[model samples]
Target: MNREAIDILVHSAWKLLEAKDYLGARELYTQGLKLDPFDATLWNYRSNAHMKLQHPELAFTDAARGLQLLDDKLATTNLSPEDRNFSVFMKIDLLFRCLLAAENLDICQTALKYIDRLLTNSHLLSNEARQTILSKQKSLKLKIKTKRHAFARASDSLRLNLNDVLNLGTMRITKYPWNEFEPFNSENDIETELKEINIMLEPIAPKLLVVRM
Candidate 1:
């Protein structure tokens, strides 16, 4: 309701944040936001405090709010270049916060989206910042690939093998009953005729191997 009081609250909040009083800073930011819910600065400050307190979900939400507010402000026509750049930097900062929160939450996909967004605004970034983001992008891609491979391996390892089910303690299974295989056209037909189809075959090394000692 009071602009002056809200400004005071924001200023005091920054001071507390600087003094490493994250709890106090968070409280002041929340009070200021209550008076002016759309204040981007308040949201940004509060997001930082949430991150300091290890609340990544809350931090991501607040940072996203700050970014949305800045985007609306930047869309207004006839803005001075100085004002535009100021808003641009603030947007970048909020985006970085979102990326950090996503990473802390182990949501690599969300972090990758934020990284791509930062890269889309590459013209606004300093050379050092651009380089850092590029490095992070590569690292994130590799991490995602690694996770995918591990999941694939785990799925194969955990799948139920019909051969194992048919194994008697005194005997070995030479073949699995393909008669029970799923996705078949008919339950009564034991054999299906092969259809002639055009296809390409590529030669590649096998992925997994076992050697008897």
Candidate 2:
């Protein structure tokens, strides 16, 4: 890798990123990666570009590769505490992007697994970032749970009587003429009352009131 070229690429790519030129930054990042495929920072930045373009699968892939490279570097290299912490933070942030990029339940579950693993080692993160990740984790868990139960809830609703199934008790129609009949109840009750009234009027059907001139 040419150090001078990498410096130029990094500088220009960062400027492009700041300017929201995600495609331009991505191209530079890709060029950088060809020179140093093991560069985790390049991977992370490239992932960012992909995310901005809504290329979730590519973003997730790059982010995951970045994490692997970071872990390998941490194990073999004697990095300063600040540098190590920053790398870890970047990885966590990338994990969040991965979560956001998830397009389906399976992908979401996979992202959750990675997130939970990082969260379990919360000491690797700053307090503020840790809290943010925890809150997001909780929200994601709730979203997944809700999605999983949605069908069951829909089916359960099928068994429900929207009108009256809670046994909330019936209302009364004791207002004026309505009081002459029974209280307002179920539809079945109303139908029964109508049937009884029709039965009582069966004989009256033949009677007619006539007028003579």
Candidate 3:
């Protein structure tokens, strides 16, 4: 397709997206992408369409490509500060979403790198937007740390439980002193013994308070 045709497709796609017809917009974006594979703006638009269509993976890939193209253009020192700042902001925002969608530690790390660069020019961003980004960064960091700590605690609990079971087995073996004794004898006998033991230990267990609704 020619430039005019690509422009027409992009315009129609934007209209469809505004109308919340994601499938139609996606089709138009796909067509436009076919005609202009290297157009960064078209890729960004396509990514928005994909996101509205609940295709996170495709959206992330397109966003990354758009950011790459933008980065290439902004690499020259001739660009105005405003233009460079805008490009950097867009890259940071896109990288943040891509990191969230991908849920990879490396992606999150990369996103933070861009975010830090953006924050260095925080004066350029609106107060609300800057605060929002800072909040998100704080929340993500907290979540990662919380998950790591919880996983460590769970691992410790599992190890303790395993050790307790092993110690119990050893005690039982010492009490029987022979494999031929058949300590359990049957499932019903084992259940009965367990019930008795639980009853004996019931008083020591933590009590639950009843609450009236």
In order, what lDDT does every prediction score? 0.71, 0.65, 0.61
Residue-wise C-alpha lDDT for candidate 1, range 24-91, written one tens digit per residue = 99999888877776677777888999999988877887788788779879999888999888888999
Q: Which candidate is the best by lDDT?
A: 1
**Model 1 residue 128 lDDT?**
99
Ranking of all predicted structures according to TM-score, beginning with the best and ending with the worst: 1, 2, 3
Which of candidates 1 and 2 reaches a greater lDDT?
Answer: 1
Which regions of candidate 2 fall more than 4 Å away from where they truly are? 77-86, 103-106, 151-213
State the lDDT of candidate 2 residue by residue for 1-213, as single tens digits.
Answer: 376787799899999989999999999988887777767788788888988887775676677667766776778568998988887777766666655555322454565676787777787678987787778678778876775477456658587553343223221111111111212233466555654564465467522211111
Q: How many steric clashes does model 3 contain?
A: 0
- At residue 53, give the lDDT of candidate 2: 87
TM-score of each: 0.69, 0.61, 0.61
Which segments of candidate 1 are over 4 A away from where they belong? 78-82, 157-213
Give the candidates in order of lDDT, highest first.
1, 2, 3
Flag the better candidate by lDDT, 1 or 3: 1
Candidate 1: 10-residue stretch with minimal lDDT: 194-203
lDDT of 3 by residue, 149-206 (tens): 7766777856655433322311111111011112322346655565455445546652
